[model samples]
Target: MPEVYHLIVNPAAGHGKAPEFVQNHVVPLLHHLGIAFELHETKGVRDAGRIGAEILTTTSFPVKVVIAGGDGTAHEMIEGVLKAERDKKDQALGRWELVILPLGTANALFSSLFPQPPEPPSEPSSLVSYLSDTGPDVLYQLSSLLASLKSTTPARRLPITLTSLESPISPPTEPIQSHIVLSTALHAAILSDSEALRSSYPGLERFKIAADQNLGVFFKADVRLIPPHSGKIKQYDPSVGNWVDPFTFGEDTLSGPFAYFLSTTTTPRLEPSFVISPLLATLPPNPSDPPTMDIIVLRPLRDPAVRSALASRGDEAASETWKSRIRQVMGWAYKGGGHVDLTYPAHRGETEVKGGGEVVVETFRCGGFEWVPTDAEHEPSHIVCADGSLHTIERNGKATVQVMDPGHDNSDDGFWVWA
Candidate 1:
């Protein structure tokens, strides 16, 4: 049980409804429960992290931090907690727990654990995407957190997937420890474009518009899935709901003039109900297993229908047709991640269109991966995204990632969330 409750709230969240709701709904409820608490509202960029680190370092033992914000706010708080200066000798002196209140565009990390379908919001929030849900469901979630804290149920340590971006001009920057997702290709492109539409559209429609803009661009790269030494690379078997290694089919490397490539730590969807990586949510990894990321990759050239259709068409026509197919795949993603279960065969020697013969989506479970984009040939492909933050991998530089689960490996002190 918590001795004190420290809430880091973002007033900007839920279209500025966070403060009003937390104050009226959350505060009174906790007070009624006799929980002692303090509220801290974020002022500017990275302010949440600053506050979180300070609390992690100085807060009383057995403290519970209730983050009344979205994933980005929670992300910053976690980053602060991880980067804070704490004596290694005092690691056992205190206990900390994190609780994200779901107040952003996408509450992918928190939703992965709760998996409760959020109720619709009565008013607009900061962004009108997955995090817009701020109805009575929020009360239920808070109550559940209360139950967990009051009971003996232990919080689960969330595994982080770290990506290191290296450029020849400088040493590798601090690894982006992502609890939800690390993405590039179509995923990053969409985020890059959609962010610009934030003020204009301010809702999920921006993502659709951005997707329309980025669907045609191909990402040129050579990729490799790096397993932990002596471990095997694995892929999801949708038919059986199990994981299997595709190494038997061929070697583990992939070269791409790619359409889509994304990896998830635990999130099954970038937004609620999109279900981009369905199995991640449905079949969470066993505690005894090594930490791994769920990756979804798409290479246009692999589709026979697209290949044959493009062969007869002019270069421009071929590109347009290819984009159409890709849009189809992305469209299927929203249909409960149905894209992964699909088989697109070669119709008229063309694999770009759905021929219904072979599976189009390539889903894998890996320890990490290397994304090396071709120089200038596909500059857009070099862009990478962790959560919502964008990073660009310069020419000749590559971004690599590894899974880190403190609960399983404990090589380093890490983080956990209120389950």
Candidate 2:
């Protein structure tokens, strides 16, 4: 029998160009290749997941799921995969491989694997800028990519980021899966706030407006960062240009009045241009290695000067310092991913330093992490973003995020992505 394909296309995804692209581009290509496929256009929220679940139940052999939408639609398909796996009591999840059509605002997962994008336009493109500034050019670029794909191409298994929220009385909140990111603090707050303004602002500008609204909002949490590869929990030192051992401080679990805490798996960015975790971009993931994610954390208390300044002045002043530092470091993201290499004077209430300074961002290469929220009552702190979907942690509850892969043992099951 010939290979079969199932497609989930979301018309509302990615500037409303998906439906047209599916009709004009995708269908023709599959037909030309003599492929047998089934296509379903998403009608409402979670429909894609439902459809994907239905597809999973009906199909037995290896099948391809071609999702032509945004990150949200891709998320639904994964959720469907999880649900189907549970319903059928299947241990493996590898039967279905996926191909993204990249028709969403972020298209974050798409940008991660294809970092520089497929074709080099006359003008250089950044994922951040691509999502921020969408136009015919992007469509053309993506079309160029679709045209280049071969039907016989193989899909690679994607490492997963699983997040579980703690609940004492009832069953634990269902763990969320993240192919792209699992974030809290500033980034999560931004995603939550930006959604409300999405109608008014429309486009990436809403995110900027939302950031302005949530600036200086601190999150208090107890963090335990565990490295995927055993040894000491590694912390990047820009001065030495190496991942030095954090164990020298004689501690593992860290307490903080955190300003930002976010983790990414498989992908290196939240946006093509907004390369939040620059370390992952420079250090590529090895297929043979165990699945892992890089975390970018900012805690004001880690800085002696900032801590003293906050006590003497107020959180507002300390916040200003943090905001300035984040802005400075992120600017480097646009250059050559210099943000991860940023350092600051930790003793003088300083935020940014050019050379021979202590690292400002607490970078971690970890297998998993537990975030016990100190300010769960604080709305922003309770918000957790798993692949742009928001979930709230209950009061006194916590969230544990981890990265896992099949690693040849469960290779027959798990999620795979086609570039």
Candidate 3:
């Protein structure tokens, strides 16, 4: 019955590239579909949310909001819809569907959900064709994405995962903020640092720069892994490409001084090459739940050569050591480093860690987690990035993230983008 659709456009997305695409292509396509739409171009950061909230609540039209920007714009639209639904019960629709148009750089969610072909010229039609061609199989692959949404029954509480940062003014507040992608140590730092460089670089290069800057740093913290709805954590057995509950590790499976610790609720592969949670999208335990978080962790102790700390020497020696560390870390990321088989060559000039050593990264799949930063010392654990937005965790406090599944008996139902 909701034939009407609301178009939320971010004119400044992709550093001012989205508007042209929307004007040239998207609008014409909407006309061809014969769909009723009201376009709302975003003004500021939260403008999409504000505009979406307005259209959803004030208008009596049966509508779906199509987000016409990248991931950041999509995220803002979602937050806006949820907030409006939460505040205005009568206007809040039973199911608010989101149709994304990937118009930003690092459109992580869109890219992960629908991988661009290896070749170039990935256009809107190609994406639509992929969706229609794959049929339900795509849904089957993204079971976690769908099921997670249903399980949350977002129409109910609309769960929010908050990461609170400690500041001199405030202690800790209730219900901090929720994030869909990259929540934790390095992820937060990358986003936090990347903001300043966004203007100068304005593209993926900014992310690369941030990664280079933060690659050598590690955060000190203790992690508490909260399992899926079943109250149990799942591990990917690469051999089978499925999630298997690891019964041994419990709440405190992770201790920090970690290099990279990030989690994703939806959209498994951030970039095509960066298969952070290959198993989440490809082989999840349940296909019905797509909202579950795929957590990727990098622990330094897992490094083979890190048996002992290297003493700092002259400027040249320190620079060389730093270079080695960077290359090693970056290599692991490139080779699908499951964090299990990372070995830093110990003796002489060898590459393998002494004795074929420890697992450098410990990856996990779960509903939520709590990151408690080290306060005794001035550690790097003072940051948390939620959906490309930065937030820091309180020194003595923790950040708890749990996946919510908003489900219904309507097996015939789900959200999809119209071609």
In order, the Cα lDDT scores of the candidates are: 0.73, 0.73, 0.59
lDDT of 2 by residue, 339-374 (tens): 777667645644454455666677888788888888
Candidate 3: where is the Cα deviation over 4 Å?
Answer: 59-63, 89-93, 118-180, 196-209, 237-242, 247-251, 289-291, 310-326, 335-358, 376-379, 407-419
**If scored against the real structure, what TM-score would every candidate get?**
0.85, 0.87, 0.74
Query: Which has the higher lDDT value, candidate number 2 or candidate number 3?
Result: 2
Q: Please give the clash total of every predicted structure, in order.
A: 16, 10, 31
Q: What is the lDDT of residue 52 in candidate 2?
A: 83
Q: Write one digit per residue (lDDT tens) for candidate 3, span 1-419.
A: 54676778888887676667566555665575565668889999889878867876666543456676777886676567666765776643445556566676557766655565443322234235533433353333232223222334331122235444444457654334443475666677788888889989987799889877877666788888876665567765433434566532455557766777877655566665666655555564355553466777766544434433434344344334544565665564545544333444545443442234333345577777877777546445867777777665554666666665454553222233321
Worst 10 residues of 2 by lDDT: 121-130
Give the best candidate by TM-score. 2
lDDT of 3 at 43: 93
Report the lDDT tens digits of candidate 1 across residue range 344-418: 654643233333466688888878899988756566888999888898897789998888645434433455576
Q: Which stretches in model 2 have alpha-carbon errors above 4 Å?
A: 90-92, 116-154, 196-205, 229-232, 247-250, 346-354
